[model samples]
Target: MEKSVFEYSHYRSYLRMRLESAGRRGSKAQIATEMGVQATYVSQVLQENAHLSLEQAEAANVFLNHTSQESHFFLLLVQKDRAGTKSLRDYFQTQLDEILKTRMVLTERLGKSTQLDEKDRSWYYSSWIPSAIHIATTIPTLRTVGDLAKAMQLSSEKVMETLERLENIGLVRKEGLQFLPGEQQIRIGKDSHYILKHHTNWRLQAMQSLEHENLKELHYSAVVSLSAKDVDKIKDLLLESLKANVEIIKDSKEEELYCLTMDFFSLLKAQK
Candidate 1:
């Protein structure tokens, strides 16, 4: 099945935002004129051109100074646009969420200092199972259900059930009688690693977990922007932020750091 309408729109939206940011001044006219095409071509690419010609894609790379990561992401968008028969975006998005959830668990378990009573610890452990499967498989050679169960001390039955659920939700597959992840699955796995390593549950939950209001004194901050330039800046800023925050936790009362984590979101900025 081709990507869902939502995923298609999102990819297009991302492309459009990147293009617009790259061509900051008169972006529409600049791209159209450079490509020897009409402004509508730029519009069409975002709305209908999922698969881009090499020429068009190259034009984007040249115009955007895209990093290797951005270039690869562009290729993915192009492939999806061409395939038009499978909604690959949905599959990966689901997997990506699961990976982040696992990272969140680890952040709470390993990254923070908290005052979790026995009951809280049990609840935390139970909540982290699904995420554990997601993270465990990321450790190559331990990707299969049995492997994940053994590595994580989870029941095989439970791991298999999670894998089945992931499959039903379009995150995994049985390719040629062997399990395989679709393109999106691979991307999700790759993405989760970075988020888990750098972004902790304290940051992620702080973005959405209003109930943790008491922690506001930590004086944390957020950065948002549409420009890839800003994204780069935010990445650096976050690294500094997390580093400093971690240092503070190490020196503070251990209980205050308990069960804390962080979250990071990198999305195309909406056009002004």
Candidate 2:
């Protein structure tokens, strides 16, 4: 199925999907006419991932009948594609991040109840399962115990017990055999007392994942001695990358459950 325009970061792919939608066969010519360009030009441009002028991109936006937000996103995609230098591309990328953040703010924002009490924190973060199950309920397919059990590779009884425990903490709400996110939101910060346990739970999960032969999963380990100066530089780069990635996660629609773990530390003992 074709995704909404907002879901696409690549303009060419979005155009191709629209043109090829059912009953819209040969729609490239229509778009060309809308943009005051030749049909062949549109055809070649899409196939080659060629740049579209800002003016042409605006015309295409109108032809596609995009919403205001989607039009803005579409223009950003074009601007990024047309950028000739890394700095220019990075500039447009920042704008794209803002657009995504604003769109997500209203729907994804957590409530004031995000901070859990001490006991609740202990129970919730004791193992990854409780928190994981709470988040999984947000996924449409994981609403049922059987569905979640199969997806998370757990037995139905285990899923049920975890679900019940989560419900007690107001993390999951059940309605007619379907599970949904609870009214209260849960957000843990680095300063949280249980943060270490939460991190440990997921880190252990990461280790187990290595046992599986998933070709698409990523794992990297390195041991090296570098200048103290470069240590800060490398750490800064990783933090910057993770910050950009968080923007994507905030705005992306949930379709699957995945975990990302990044660890970098000094092997040498610290001097007092």
Candidate 3:
């Protein structure tokens, strides 16, 4: 008995096995012809020297006659393999396994419950408090109002107020004299109002950072015209990149807190 198609982690290997099982074995040229690509390109992909583009992958999926679920799995395998960073590969691989095991559509799973309560929502949207609390968690010496205020370059009164709010919200717990981060997931629903305010505040802060003379942070901007289809692809890539960064940060051994923010939007309407 052979392994199922879903068991193969590598898309190239899966394609090879799929082709062989379909009685189209030992001929790269045939596969290339089906995919409308050159024989050498197919050879490179099979040899792990190259990868399939999104278009190529979709074409191959069609050629293989994969069902919707199998096609999705194949695309995820390609995404996992083509990921530029290890963190991204790991994240997508995890997602692939979960989807296969649970027999759940990725989009449907993503749309399910992962929301913060009102208190947590309010606590996270305020921004500086969460940052301060995270920093304090890593640096025990920066636990008190005066210490945190001086470290964060804010007034003691403001830090005190934020700390009290965080405590009331159950995001921080007092262990002896030091504050520790609560074991909580800070997830917000897609339609949450806090999402808008959170993004607005960060975008404003990002713009403000440009005016500071001694700023050492990185800021980049680009404007380009793209098809709506390509825009959707870009959005998916951005989301995957964000998730990858979160995974990387979560696995870090040292505590150097930093906020990662990204903003992408259309600046012009498509011409009819």
Candidate that scores best on lDDT: 2
Best by TM-score: 2
Quote the lDDT for 229 in model 1.
84
lDDT of each: 0.51, 0.79, 0.69
**How do the candidates rank by lDDT, highest first?**
2, 3, 1
Q: Higher TM-score: candidate 1 or 3?
A: 3
Better of 1 and 2 by TM-score: 2
Model 3 gets an lDDT of 0.69
| RMSD to native, candidate 2 | 20.3
lDDT value, residue 126 of candidate 3: 76
lDDT of 1 by residue, 1-272 (tens): 21221233245666665454532667767766766678877887767653457677667654543333334455555554555345676654554455446645744553343233334333323444544444444344555666667766777667766665443333444321123442223122333333453334435545554644564444355665467787688778988999997798656642221335544665546733
Candidates 2 and 3 compared by TM-score, better number: 2
Give the clash total for candidate 2: 0
lDDT for position 96 in model 1: 44
Which residue pairs in candidate 2 have backbone atoms (N, alpha carbon, C) closer than 3 angstroms, thus clashing? none
lDDT of 2 by residue, 1-272 (tens): 45666677778888888887688877898889999999989988789646789999999977775545567899998988888899999999899888777756633543435555667777888888887888898889888877999999998777877886665556776653466788876787888778788789998999998899487889888789889999899999999999999999999887888887789887667742
- List TM-scores for all candidates, in order: 0.28, 0.57, 0.49
